[model samples]
Target: MDARASAIAVRDESCVGDEFAPDIPGLKARRFWIRNSGCVIAAALLVTLSSTALLEPLSDVAPPTGPEQKKPVVLARTRRQSVTSPKKARLWMPRTGRPETLDLVERMGDGSMSQTSYFDISLDLNENASGSAASSASAVAQVADTGANPFDLVLQDALDARQLMRHSGLGYAADAPKAVRPADQSNVTVTPAQEAMLVRRIVSLPVQPERLRDIKGVIGVSEQDFAQLASGLGGDVVRKGEQLDLIIGQRPAQPNLSEILFARHLAADGRERLLARCDDGHFQLVTDHRPYDRMVAEALAHQAAEARSGSAQAVPKDVAALQDAAADYPKLIEHLARRNVPVKVSLQIVQLLRANGIHWSKTADVPQLDFVFRTAEQGEQELVSVTLKGKGRDRRFYRYVSDSGKPEFFDDAGRSVSKTLMHKPVSAGQLGDGFGWRVHPILRTRKFHNGVDYRAPMGSPIVAAGDGVVVKIDSETGYGKYIRIQHDGGYTTTYAHIEGTPKGLRVGDHVAQGQVIAYVGSTGLSTGPHLYYELRVGDTYKDPTKAEMPAGTTLRGRALEEFRQQIGRVETIASTIRATATSAAHSAVSALTPGSDKQ
Candidate 1:
């Protein structure tokens, strides 16, 4: 088709629906009316009401008195009263005014005075007002002399002044009107009890600066007095830049006797006593004395038995002394233990006393004995040290951290007490299979087993045999889900047939000994739920039950030398404590044993 013919055809098709389209202008006009018709009607009604209001006031005016005199229209009026009715009137006056006579006058309808009666009025001033009686009386007298109403004078003064000024002050003349002072400006005398109550109320108030500022404005106290009040309430007033800050310190409550006793029982030095103040205003040592009392009773019974047995013969002085020492030995040992001496050290001390033939009465003659066990923190590390004064010298032990980052306790000879690996890692389980040739439970064939099995209920916890880093964590064909850990001394351990490992456990993560890493399961080629554990030394399997494990790390060189120095420091502290205890013991023994000579 030709270009012009094609354009004409397209235009005809586009105009097919034009005749059926709604009128846009008509729709728009309807919408505009719907949205704003109410506003237009309201505006017209307001204008009409305003015009009626403006014309109504003109009705009250009388019409012009020309040939026709028109009456004035009254919009509203009250009902008339009877002429014989009597009305009572009240007149108000200032409370500060003295007694004075007032004339009550009545006027008739024609505006002429008819009757006049005299009445006396007297008023008293408000007690809460800052204006003194003298100032109030003077103000009233001045108003009377000026022939002005005292009520108006007092009302004007109250409205014009912000604060009530003191009339007796030298700054103002006696006759001149003084500045008014507010009622709150009067000096307030607070007792100690009231001050304490106010302190409590102030502490509970909000600590915001705006809140505190409002309180200060209302209280009208000087900054110095406020500071003194805060100090008495166990608070500090600090000036921060231009702002003042109050810091209230709450005193820590003293622990009760029961709480104190619980703490002492759990403390390292259980023998420590507390000097507590009693309600009767005296101090007494608080300690568990039941154990000491039992020991003393046992000693007394033994002494009496020995004396009765020797009644039949004349006992020699040496024999009697030996019996006395024997009777006191048990009591003395208990006393040493109560003083925080170690059992081993106490035994050595008793042997020393026996060899020297020293009676309990002569305990002060024995060599000064010292023993200490303490945990101390140095920098970021915590160390436990023990010192024993025995066998004529002091022996020490220390828990030191090794190069492998494991802590081990070492004695004076540098020997460690902890073992390298645990024989059994799990708490509750039975040994199922040992490392050797064993018949496979599922396959029904003999196979060389590389590990041992611990039969346990499903989901039983499996712990690490030693402190090590996890080297492997993945599923295997026959082992199923398993984890292998690499320990020191060329040793490695494996835990197989685990249902699942703990969350967040991954390869290269360090695990401590006895830490639960996984749970037991019957995965892979197994019969039931069990833990397959293996121990290897450089790829060679070892029977955990038969093979001798490595001992804990030993201290050498500088480590050993430092341990000896720690022992000396502990001994020094122990010696000071022992000397004090010995003096107290000497006094106690003298009191218990009548006629015993003091050493």
Candidate 2:
């Protein structure tokens, strides 16, 4: 369109509202009249705009609408079961930190439990409904002597539980239902609102045995010695005074007393005896005497006289006969070897057999004997060449077959398979501290330590015991910068005093076995930058060395058999710690616990 026509269209739209525009072409002529139409349109538009502006002030004075509505209301219910027989029941909920009040219900034998119809007991912190300070004091007084709570529930944490019971007085031990056992009489004497929970009576041996029978020649012997001997014999030592009680049931009876006295058979003489009787009722074998040999000898001599008419063919001195005789022999030949035997005669006997035809057989992987002696003196020099086959199970028994289908024997102490057993990854480090009661360097008195302390340099990689979840990671009062991993089988372990913890590591993170989680550090209450390690069963701290560590699950079936057999050979390696007794074993085992170099 021409400029004149465009100008006219714009003027017409701007002036009146463009309602008068024609849709047809040739608007060019209209442009020429656009300038003329502009003045006319401006005057008309001014009148219209002036009228709207004048009327706008009147529109602002109108009235308002109703007030804002509130949100819709909906009634909902939250349901919770209450504890039935609240007044009569004495319940205990065990946990750490805050104690939660739970509604307890009693379950019947059929798996149905009694429920509270509708009753909620509200606890008021203020006023008389609140537990009294005097009641708290009384609960403390009651539990102080027992070392446990009277509510039949011990706080998962004993000390913390006692403090809560003392301060809150939330439980009524006096109201506990009558004890179901003989000790229930004590419950009736409990005072009201008092911590009347039943405390497990400490089991102890009576002050003395009522009957003091006339006895003589029985002297107290070391229980450890007895235990060691019993273990070597694959039997347990139950100690009586100077004598250990032997429990010999009839597995298979020996030929006679002569068979046992001569160490020809290991079959029992058919008797079982309880060893020692202690004040704590804890009995162990008394390994102070060799009563078995003498008893068997006497019994054998009597039986021999009666059977003198029978064919007393010369017994082929074989390993089986020796094993039978030594089964009831009180002299612990095996224990003596491990703990330094003083018997020179036994050593000479062993040397003679080992140097002679008694060579180790490759077939059974055990030593064999091929000589028989008519006299104990000839045992040192006699050499009757005859092939014999057998497997050495102990120092007394070598079950083997002779060339003539007859079992032959020797009087040599058989070596044990377990004697050569050694634990894997032998660690070569000093044991700094052990788990259990020790004087706290900071506390200045005895305290229960839940873990072990390993002395190592900083930045040492701390390995995970097994695959587990990192449940906790924090620096606490005594434990500085600790990491806890929850493993399977209710096992949990902690590694503390870590330096340079890996990034992105946090709680709920899964870790694999042998994964490096952190480095050693002196972060918390440590004496130096060493690793402090702990093993917990559920929440109870246990001696890491004593606690059964989870071995690789892959080592099962044939793998486990091989592993066990391998360890059998491994245990024979002498521990780095000086072998003394109990303390030495603890020290040796501690080297394998966490945070220490176990290799």
Candidate 3:
């Protein structure tokens, strides 16, 4: 035995001897001796085991004194076996939250309510998830059991779904049972040409959600997988024939097709993704849909490239094509019409399209063809309209059309036409801070703060104070994200703590007056969400609140007169909106009145 165990045994022996000789309680002393003897034996065995691997030998020679150590075993949940029956299985897709739990009672052979049970495969979104990775791993592990499927399926991100498939080693089923077709079947039709068109249209769309210009190849995901996805997507997506349509219900008349294409791209794996360039010179994601079109376009481009390298002559153009030689008359007459297009714009449009073979066609009682000539002015713009009359080879037509001293476009789509030169500043409320103020929040002391702060939310629109060139856009550093625009007369304006800058505006990019360049944010050294606006003249910071800055835009002459004429229409619409709102309020009150509807 080790020294410590020997010492403990000797001490216990001495204590037992003393208790027997001097203590009156002999029975209690005998009990203590028995307990000490057991402890000594246990300690000796533990020490022997610690010094050498003799526990196995000891167990063989003697016996175990206590229960043995063990690993807790977990058993998989067993599913009760049922006799096979001719019953159709229908999948129920749950909403964003869990559906009411329905207990299974019995099953009837028919699809009626005579006897049935529904196991609601409801989802609990706010359920205490075991975290993303752990839940994914556990879900994948469940597939290994051969007795029965633990889960029907898990709806997750495309990456997670793919990972689950890989770990689970489940083969994708291309063909699956589909919902029964409508009895009428009047609206459904399958056409080879239409299929080709649909594929072409999908592939031609851009890969990026914002700019659907990338033309990647197409991929054919399994039909079963796609059906499941369609079910999960709810009614937001419409599946007609082989095409999936994602419609933004807000704009029902002109539903955006590109957004739907982007949604599909996001759901697909990177391995099957198609790559293409958008019109804005950015890379976009796409899918492999039309192999033939892509192959043809690639081949043609390659051949053209090879020909160029081999010093080939000019590329071919259609020899049978004809040009319109009598196209300049209407354009020239349209140029002379100052009443319709602004005189300056009319002249410029005529000058640009002077010798070009522009065609004119007549429709109903009004002229339809118009040409807009870009001008050198910062914000001023113009267009020329020409009446036309032509049908075939011998037909000819010519006339001039103009607006006749009326304002052509509303300055703001959200606001009514302005009656005065001074339209209300883009947003309402009041200025909270003067420019070049020195203040501290925590210490309550003075420190030179560069900009004036405007109280607003994180996503409030920040409009351009004037037409200007964006000289700086900082996406990093102490300012967080900011935009500095250099306006006319060497004046510069800066807006800081922006949620996001305008889509394409960068350094040297021009911005029109009143255009939204950024949204307010609390990104930088800010106490709360607000816009830190600064106006600078040359290198000197000016007090924006006190400074009488020149107005950036003005309505003049006929434009002003037209604006004045629009006041009555604007007021009438405003009044109508107010009346409608009041009527709605009154109806709501009446409906809520005690025993009104119930009575």
Candidate 4:
């Protein structure tokens, strides 16, 4: 067509306000340029129009009402400004400090649509509905007299979190890759709203015996110790590759000490931070790098600010009473270990309590506190709750003064639970020899067999019989590869002729009842792949199947109520942290290889 004709066609179809040519569906504000004979072009004209204009048939259709009608509004493809000199992007959401670039907003769990707001999620993170403060003061005083050191207890508890693995439960996998949520992303959760929901769930969860115990222990720290505890526990959220935020599920929140009372997280550096949580919720630092006092001062200032704002507030903690409980915690555990109580279960219980906020702490110095309970077997002893032989009141020592004039407290210890035992260490095996005198297969003489033997394949997994520390893990001329675990009540169990334990595990490391400690094999003196097990009461060995050890005990009265309450907590957090089912036996792990640690 001629220039004149082409011009007329262009003007009629796409000229300004032309009805014949509809706007493009995708491009928001499109600019069109008209040219004559491909020589010179007129200035481009930018026009704003709807994206749905092109799809007239589909765009005209209305969406369903009610639930099905809920959907994020799709912002049409907007025509960007001039390519020669574009404008800078304006920041919107504070989390990323960048303009919204996503195609569409995600739907909430309730199927409701949400617009991009200043924060990642609009749910208020500072919402706290806890009353632990009102009761904590009295409880703290009661526990402080019990000699619990809250600071030391928390520090040691981290070391002991791994010990809780003794109980067979699913939890955070030790070998699982570190979860470092990116700054723009939420922790293990998908969004902040979801995280808030999880926090709510955790809050609604009744304080279990273990967690209450832990929380109590934590609250007992001296103010001085509390500061130290904060520093020690306080560090950049990410250690190595493991993001503390992901581990603790702490996302950065605006640091408003006046609004957020408790210290949740304080920034460690410009980008990273240290996270903490209370029964209520979490706190965060705005900028990284602040002293411990600075954060606490915020709470103090917040308290004052609240007072000025004329709002009711709970008093902040000034000291740590459970400070002494730290020393007493392990001591109490040791005492139970020396007794007929299941040491593994007891230690785990202590660890669980240590890990939680228990209100009570018993120390050796607590004037006349002696725990008395019934034994699990024939040798067991059960008595009425009465004054002991030399009961005397000692107000100077502790507050719980017994009616018989002694500041003594009595309660049932150890519950009637399954005795820690490995029915079969080998995944697939059979009893080859009984625990008694037998004709020595290799020695060719009648000798007393110290342990029962399980004949199995060369490389089957072997677990601990009960919870205990591996006192010895070495090989000898007779026992090829052996691991000896010292249990409660002066009892020690040995597994001989095993492949080996994993690296990182040493003699002092703790193991759980069902934790896989070794792989079955013949290391020392053995005919084939067989596990030689030995149960020793002090010096003399006993039959594994016949000997009646204090397996577990049942709690009654208040203690039972405490246990029933505490188990939920122990299970709640512990359930999420799981170890590899195979232990050091994983194919690629650095476990002791076959014949590697032979004595």
Looking at model 1, which ten-residue stretch has the lowest summed lDDT? Answer: 195-204
Against the reference, the lDDT scores of all candidates come to: 0.45, 0.38, 0.38, 0.39
Please write out the lDDT profile of model 1 over residues 126-177, one tens digit for every residue.
1123233333333333322343321111111221111111111111122243
lDDT of 3 by residue, 390-496 (tens): 24322111111113223222332111111111121227324556555566663477877766677775687888876567898886655678888876445788887
lDDT of 4: 0.39
Model 4: ten consecutive residues of lowest lDDT: 195-204
Which segments of model 2 are wrong by more than 4 Å? 1-430, 551-599
In angstroms, what RMSD does candidate 3 have relative to the true structure?
A: 34.1
Local error of candidate 3 at 503, Å?
Answer: 1.7
| TM-score attained by model 4 | 0.27
- State, as a TM-score between 0 and 1, how close model 2 is to the true structure: 0.23
RMSD of each: 46.3, 41.0, 34.1, 29.6
Query: On a 0 to 1 TM-score scale, where does candidate 3 land against the true structure?
Result: 0.23
**Number of backbone collisions per candidate:** 8, 38, 14, 57
lDDT of 4 by residue, 1-599 (tens): 78798567565654455344556642213324432322332222212123334455675355455666656666454432322324434212121111101111212235433321110101111122122333333343443344321111100112121222211111223423355458734223442222110010011122211222222222222233234324544431222212121111222242211121223221324243444433434344433212222222122222222223432221123123222232444333223322222222233333333322232333222222222121121222221121111225421110122222222222223333224345565667789889888999998999999889898887888877765678998889888888998874468888898888876889888665667888888777788998898889988988887665542222346755654443343332222111111111121111112322121
Residue 523 displacement (Å), model 1: 2.4
Over the stretch 477-571, how does candidate 2's per-residue lDDT look in tens digits? 88878898886445788888777578898889866556678887888777877777788787588777655454221223453454444333212
Q: Pick the lDDT winner.
A: 1
Candidate 3 Cα errors over 4 Å, as ranges: 1-430, 442-445, 476-478, 551-599
Q: Give the top-scoring candidate (TM-score).
A: 1
